[model samples]
Target: MNAKRKNKILTWIATISFGVISLIALFPIISLVISSLRPSSELMRQGISFSINFSQLSLDNYLYIFNQAPEYWAWYGNSLVISAITIVLSLFFSSMVGYALAVYDFKGKNFFFLLVLLILMVPFEILMLPLYQLMINTQLIDTYFAVVLPMVVAPVAVFFFRQYALGLPIQLMDAARIDGSTEYGIFFKIMLPLMGPSLAAMAILQGLGSWNNFLWPLLVLRSNDMFTLPIGLATLLTPYGNNYDVLIAGSVLTIIPIIILFVFFQRYFIAGLTTGGVKG
Candidate 1:
C-alpha cells in the first residue's frame, strides 16, 4: 500500500477500536438507566438487565424521586455542596503547595517535598483513625468542614501539580519580579495560567472523588439530613425491604454532574495528566 493508504488504514483501525471500547465502558450507564425505568417487581426478579422489555418499563421511578423523595434531594444538595467545596479548596491549596515546592528554594524544601511523597505513599485507610480523631477533637463532626478540611491538601494533587510545575519556565517568575510583581501576583498572574492543564485535570478528578466519596463522609456526618448521596442511597436497602426503584434512578442521576464535569474539562484532562508526569 502507498503511504497515504497505510495511514488511512491505521486511522480506521484506531477509530473502530476506540468505538468498541467506548460502548463497553458505556454499558453500565446504559444498564443503570434501563434498570431505573423498570418497576421494583421487574428489577427484583432478574436484577439490572441489558435486555429491553418496553412493556415492563415505566416512569414511576422518576416520578417518585421527583415528587416523594425529599430526603433524596437533600442528600443530593449536600453532596453538591460538599463536592464543590472540596474541589475548590483542594485545587487552590494543593496547587499553591505544589507550585512552591517546584519553584522556591526554601530552607527545608527537599525535606518537605520528601514528606509529601512519603505521605502520598501511605494509604488513607492507615491514616483514617488519626484523621477521624482529629475531626472529633475539633468538634467538626457532622459539619461540612469535617469532610472538606482533610481533603483540602491532597498529597497526590500536590505531587501532580509539583511535577507539572517543575516543567514550567522559572524565568517568567524572574521577569514578573523585575516588572514589579509580588510573589502572589507572580503565581496568580503568570504561573497559574501556565498550569491550566494540571488544574483542569485535578478539578475533574477531585470532583469525581468528592462526589463518590462515601467512607470519610459516612464517618463524620451524623444527621440523616446531613448525609451525602452515597450514604443516603445506602439507606435504601434494608434486610426487611429494598427500594431499588428510587435507588437505581437516583444512582443514574448521580452520574449527570460527573458527566458534565468530564465533558467540560476533557480537552485539558488528557494533556494535563500526561504533562504532569513528564517532568517527575
Candidate 2:
C-alpha cells in the first residue's frame, strides 16, 4: 500500500479502537447513574436490565442513606479530612525533596534519587505488617493521625515534581541568587509559581489515592466512626445481598469530588502529565 493509504488505515483503526474502549468504560458509570435514579421497586423488577422508569425516579434512596446511615456521613467527613491533609503535606514535602534533587549538587544525590525509585518499587502490601505494628506501638490505631501521618510523603509525587522541575531553567535560580534572593524566596516566589501544573496533578493523584484507600484504613480503624468512604460503602453489602440503589448512590457520591477537581483543573492536569513525561 502507499504511505498515505497505510496512514489512513491506521488512523481509522485507532479511532474505532478508542470508541469501543470509551463505550466500555462509560457503560458502568451510565448504568450506575440510571440505577441510582430508579426506585427500588423498579430496580427489582428490571432484574439486571439497564432500563429505568423515568416516572419512578426519586431522591428517597439518597435521603434515606443520609438519615439512616449516620456513619456514612462520618466516613465521608473522615475521608475529606484525610485527603485534604495528605494532599497539602505531600505537596509541601515532595516539592522540597524534588527541588533538592533537581537543583542541588552534592555527593550521593544520584543514590538518593535511586532510593526514591527503589521505594516506589516496593508495594504497599509489603509494608503493611510493619506499619500496622508501628501504629500499634505508637497508639495511633483508631485515630485520624494514623492515616494522615503515614502518607504525608509520597515517592511518586516526588519523582513527578523532580522531573517537572528539571525542565525549569537554571538561569532563573542563578539570577534570583545573584539578586540576593534567599533559597526559600527563590522556591516560593519563583519555582512554585512555575510549578502550578505539576502541583495540581500531584494534588489530584494524592487526593484520590488517600480518599479511596481501604486496606490501610481497615487495618488501623476499627470503629464505625473512624471509617473512610470506601470502608463505609463496603459495609452496605450484607450476607443477604447488596442494596443496589443505595450502593450505586454511595459510589456516585464518592466520585463527585474527583470529577469536580478534574473538571476545574483539567488543563493544568493534562499539561502536567505531558510536561513530566517529556522531561523524564
Candidate 3:
C-alpha cells in the first residue's frame, strides 16, 4: 500500500480505539447517573441490571439524602474543610521545598533529594501504625488537624513542583536578585505567579486524595460527628440492610466538587501534567 493510505488506515484505527476506550471509561459513570435518576422502586427491581426507563426520574432520593441524612451533610462539611486545608497547606510547603531544591545548590542538596526519592518509594500503609501512634501521642486524634497535618507534606506534590520548576529560567531569578528582591520576595512574587498551572494541578490532585481518604480518617476519628464523607458512606453499608438510592446520591455528592474543580482548572491541570510528564 502507498504511505498515505497506510497513514489514513492507522488514523482511523486510532480514532476507533479512542472511542472504545472513552465508552469503557464513561460507562460506569453513565450507569450511576442513570440509576441516580430512576425511582427507588425501579432500582430495587432492577438490582444491578442495566435496564433503563426514561420516564422514571425522581428527586426523592436526593431530597431524602439532604433532608433525612443529617450525618451526610456533616461528613460532607468535614471532608470539604479538611481537603481544602490539606490542599492549601500542601501547596505552600511543597512549593517552598520544591523551589529550594530546584533553584538552589546547597550542602546536602543531593542527599535531601535522594531522601525524598527514598521516602516516595515507601508506602503510606507501612507507616500507618507508626503514624497512628504518633497522632495518639500528640493528642491530635478525633480532630480535623489529625487528617490535615499528615497529608500536608505530600512528597508527590513536592516532586511534581520540583520537576515543573526545573523548566523555569534562572535568568528570571537573577534579574529579581539584581533588582534587590529578597529570596522570599522572588519566590512568592515571581516564581509562584509563573507556577499557577502546576499549583492548580497539584491542588486538584491533593484535594481529591484528602477528600476521599477513608482508612486514616476512620482510624483517627472516633466520633460519628467527625467522620468524613468516605467514613460516613461506609456506615451506610450495615449488615442489616443497605439503601442503594441514598448511597448512590451520596456518591454523586462526593464527586460534584471534583467535577467542578476540573471544569474550572482543566487547562492548568493538563498543562501541569504535560510539563511533568515531558521533563524531569
Candidate 4:
C-alpha cells in the first residue's frame, strides 16, 4: 500500500479500537443510569444489569429524589460548595508553592520541596489520626473547615504544578521584574494566565477528589445536614433496610457536577498532563 493509504488504514483501526474501549468504560455508568430508572426491588433481585424490563421501568426514583429527598439536596449542596472551595484554594496555594519551587532559589527551598515530595510518599490514612486530632484541638470538627483544610494544598497538585512550571519560560518572570513588577504581580498577572492548562487540569482533579471524599468528611461531620453526597448516600443502607430507591437515583445525580467540571476543563486537561508529565 502507498504511505497515504497505510496511514489512513491505521487511523481507522485506532479509531475503532478507541470507540470500543470508550463503550466499555461507559458500561458501568450506563448500568447505573438504567438502575436509577428501575424499582429498588428490581435492583435487589438482579442488581445492576443491562436487562431492561420495558414494562417495569419507571421515573419514580427520579421523581422521589427531586420532590421528596430534601436530605439529598442538602448533601448535594454540601459537596458542591466544599469541592469548589477546595479546588480554588488547592490551585492557589499549591501553584504558588510549586512555581516558587520550580523557579526561585531561596534558603530552605530545597528542604521545603523535599518535604512536599516526602508528603507525596506518605499515605493520607497514616496522617488521618494526627490531622483529626489537630482538627479537634482547633475546634473545627463538625464544620466545613475540617473537610476543606486538609486538601487545600494537596501534595499531588503542588507536585504537578511544580512539574508543569519547570516547562514555563523563566525569562518572562525576569522581564516582569525588570519592568518593576512585584513578585505577587508577576505571579498573578503574568505567570498565572500562562499556567491556564495546569490550573484547569488541577481544578478538575481536585474538585473530583474533594467531591468524592468520604472518609475524612465522615470522620469530622456530626450532623446529617452537614454530610456530603458520599456519606449521605452511605446512610441510605443500614443494618435494617436499604433505601435503594433514593440511593441509585441520588448516585446518578452525583455524577452531574463531575460531568460539568470535566466538560469545562477537558480542553486543557491533555495539554496540562502532557507538559506536566514530560517536564522535570
TM-scores, all candidates, are: 0.86, 0.85, 0.87, 0.86
lDDT of 2 by residue, 1-280 (tens): 6999999999999999999999989888777776777776566656547555678778887987777867678888999999999999999999889888998899999999999889877899999999999999999899989988768878888898888888888899999999999999999899988988789888877887798888999899889898898887888765444565567677888877677877898886565445436435
What lDDT does each candidate get?
0.87, 0.83, 0.83, 0.86
lDDT of 1 by residue, 140-228 (tens): 99999998887899988898899889999999989989999999999998899999878988887777779889889988999989999
In the predicted model 1, the residue pairs found to clash are none
User: What does candidate 4 score on TM?
Assistant: 0.86
How far is 168's C-alpha from truth in model 2 (Å)? Answer: 1.8
lDDT of 4 by residue, 1-280 (tens): 6999999999999999999999999989988888888998878778777677979889999999899989999999998899989988899999999999998989998899899888877888988999999999999999998999989888888888888888888999889899999999999998889888789888877877788898999899989999999999999876443689899989988886667656776776555434435435
Q: Of the pair 2 and 4, which is ahead by TM-score?
A: 4
Q: Report RMSD (Å) for each prediction in the order shown.
A: 3.3, 3.5, 2.9, 3.3
Clash pairs (backbone) in predicted model 4? none
Over 4 Å off, model 4: 1-24, 239-242, 267-280
Q: Candidate 3 residues 1-280, lDDT tens each? A: 6999999999999999999999989888777777777776677666546667677778878988978988888888999899889989999999899878898989998888888778878988889999999999999999999988878888777888888798888799999899999999999999998988789888877877788788899899989999998998898775443576677788888877677877888886576445436435
lDDT of 4: 0.86
Error of 3 at 280 (Å): 8.4
